[model samples]
Target: MLIGYARVSTLEQREDLQVDALKAAGCDRWYVDHASGAKASRPELDRMFEVLRPGDVVVVWKLDRLGRSVQHLVDVMVRLQGMGVGFRSLTEQMDTTTPGGVLVFNVFAAMAQFERDLIRERTNAGLKAARARGRVGGRRRKLGSSDEAMIRQLYDSGSVTVQEIAGRFGVSRGTIYRTIARTSKG
Candidate 1:
């Protein structure tokens, strides 16, 4: 079974070209979506996946119609391959059912992984440098010295509950407890 998927970035855009190409490629079933590729949710795409069975090949008019980026394309291809389904892009002449297509897809998958690794390494290095400069990556501290002192005083007075302190400071009760723990440890 050759399933077709056609998409347009906006409602104003027409999917006629893609649909025609997919039909020409001998697609037995069709799924269409009119949404941005950047969006993660696509009801038609999800439905297509649900209807896909082993040995079914998913055909798209173009590679970009199926994924937002190379990484995303690789991920979707890998998932389809794992499920014993194949993929074909009419414009790109990519057919994962062929040996040559498998080789090309493997290279693409490797490149995507390499790109992700490079990004991860750079991010880690940046965070390390920031930490060396006495800067940390996270939300800004919501409580100041005065707030901490007031919270401590309130807790010690035995007249205020943890929830009350948290409400007054606009933080969670767990945060108040952790603050008290840190102060006691210091």
Candidate 2:
């Protein structure tokens, strides 16, 4: 079964072009969504997925109409392939049910993975350089060295409850406990 999916960015925009293309391409049934490509929620798209069978092919007027980005497209393709379903982009003339389309989709998946790996490598390198310069990556310390003395004094006196000390210090009881432990260690 050939199932079509068409989308327009807004409710005001008509899906005439995509709808016509899908019909001409011999789509058995179609779904349309008045939602932005970047949106994760598309009710009609979700419905289409529920009705899809093993041999059903999902057809879109263009590749962009189906995904927010190349990576997103690759992810959707991977999911479809896993379900034993195929994908077709009319504008791109790509059909995953065909040999050439399979080759092209594989290349796309590879490229997306390569791009993600490169991004991860660059981020790691940047963090390493920052660490070498004595910069840290985590959240800033809530308590300073100067506060340790007063915290210890209050804790040793045992007049203030741990919860009260935490409230005064604007931190969690865990922070108060850690503070007392560190001071005791010193």
Q: Give the number of the best model, judged by lDDT.
A: 2
Task: Tell me the deviation in Å of residue 105 in model 1.
Answer: 0.7
lDDT of 2 by residue, 1-186 (tens): 999999999989999999999999999899999999998768998898889889999999999999998899998899899889999999999999999999999999999999999999999999999999999999987999888789999999989999999999999999999899988945
Query: Could you tell me the TM-score of candidate 2?
Result: 0.82
Best by TM-score: 1
TM-score of every model versus the real structure:
0.92, 0.82
lDDT of each: 0.92, 0.93
Candidate 2 backbone clash number = 0
In candidate 2, stretches whose alpha carbon ends up further than 4 angstroms from where it belongs are 146-186
lDDT of 1 by residue, 1-186 (tens): 999999999999999999998889999889999999997669999999898999999999999999999899998998899989999999889999999899989999999999999999999999999999999799988998888888888988889899999999999999999888867734
Query: Looking at model 1, which ten-residue stretch has the lowest summed lDDT?
Result: 177-186
